[model samples]
Target: MPNKTLRVERVTKRYGALTAVNQLTLTIRAGEVFALLGPNGAGKTTTLEMIEGLRQPDEGRVWWGDVDLAQKPAYARQRFGVQLQNSEFFELLTVRETLELFHSLYRQRLAVPDLIVRLDLAEKQHARVGSLSGGQRQRLALACALVNDPEIVFLDEPSAGLDPQARQNLWAVIRQLQAEGRTVVLTTHYMEEAAALADRVAIVDHGTILDEGTVDELIHRHTPSAVLELSREVGRDVASALSSVQRVDIQADALLLVTDQLEKTLIELVNWANDHQRPLTGLKTRQATLEDVFLTLTGRSLRE
Candidate 1:
């Protein structure tokens, strides 16, 4: 019933020499959706598990309001809900039955009928868990997490395997939860998902936090310049001739140039091309995005 603030301070988890989380510290404010984003093996799930009281950390602490998770795990867990990367359901149980079972377990039961409808399960309420589609089952798992009307919810890849429409439906439900003043912590590999839903984001890599901020702020911080793509091959001569360009790199078959003066760069390129009688073809320019920033920082893709 009290106000909630989820905090993880200097948390570390390890297995032999392979550290899973390395002295990570993060805070999720009340009623905000904070996203933990990283590639596979980046220790995202490990960090979330420790905070959920499912995995104890080797060092540091997790707190739910004033309750210390390592010291009082039961008390901490009761205040939040978790939809893990893999959630299990009784295969034979109908959707309504599953909701009823979870409802009975919680000290405070949310209205199953309303929840079922809100989660878009009204028609499938009678369907057995095993018979539902992947998206349907995903929605069911999310509904179970909310059956307790938890003050905080942790969702690990809630929209991973769902279709675009189904993912959008889930996003709508998440927004509604935030609108109701419930704090949500989510882990996702999808950049667009984080950009669209998260109030703040933490980019994790190598078992540590690399960057954290609003989507726009992060993009602006790391990739402060625009990129111009040219169709022509970047030969040794052409590459050396681009002294007017501050930074020049090749991505795929395109050349990425980061510069403070786009106009000057374009003018120089045009003059050089005219002097050499070489045509500048297929030129395009775009502002940097979160994907560009992440790739620049991590030197890898989100799914890699």
Candidate 2:
């Protein structure tokens, strides 16, 4: 496969009064893992669908290198692998049998048993799809997607229902895909998943991109400040007096002092508390993270 960037240019999709995606544009560099991250109803799923050629954008275009996806839907179907948000398979087929069924549809594919083993379904190769656990089912869906030996893989919430260990396992598989020089695009709301897997990330909401960059870039750009939390609420005046503090936020469970100089702020707060004969209860400090960046941009929790 040629090393060409996958581009989504000014893509927009709408359903009645709701605009699911708004002039969204981004690029996926060849052989890199790209993540589209946002909360539910954030247009993440719609964006993936449009690029996978499963759903048409009401406006704009998608291009894999010089080939326009809109103009060549078969080109996408032959080269792009997609694992849908909801992948339904025949219930009674064994795992291997299902993989074989999908393999037969494509001109190029991994051997059914090899694909099953690659997905870690070796032990359950004969297990009926209906009897497989949620994680197994997810792996089967992934296996089906790979049966086409696609150049670009689109995964929508690939690890949504997976447990911690299973999620890590899947992350390893994604990393392997990257190492093998395949472009991967996955949409996820899990901050850690995106941070751990993506070479670059685009944070999207309300059908448009809010920010796009490496995880560290987004965090440092939007939330360069560290957070110092106190168990009890403190007035803005008190927090503002702290050294190098940028702002103060009153969270439901604590008072947060946002500061560029974390060590200086904590020292100042401790000295003030000592002088005033008051305890700085439950003092905790942490560097800003992707979650903070998301909240800073969207003004809401990512889980929302």
Overall lDDT per candidate, in order of appearance: 0.85, 0.88
Runs off by more than 4 Å, candidate 2:
232-243, 249-255, 275-278
Residue 117 of model 1 has an lDDT of 90
Question: Candidate 1, TM-score vs. the true structure?
Answer: 0.91
Best by TM-score: 2
Pairs that clash in candidate 2: none
Per lDDT, the best of the predicted structures is 2
- How big is the positional error of residue 299 in model 1, measured in Å on the Cα after superposition? 2.7
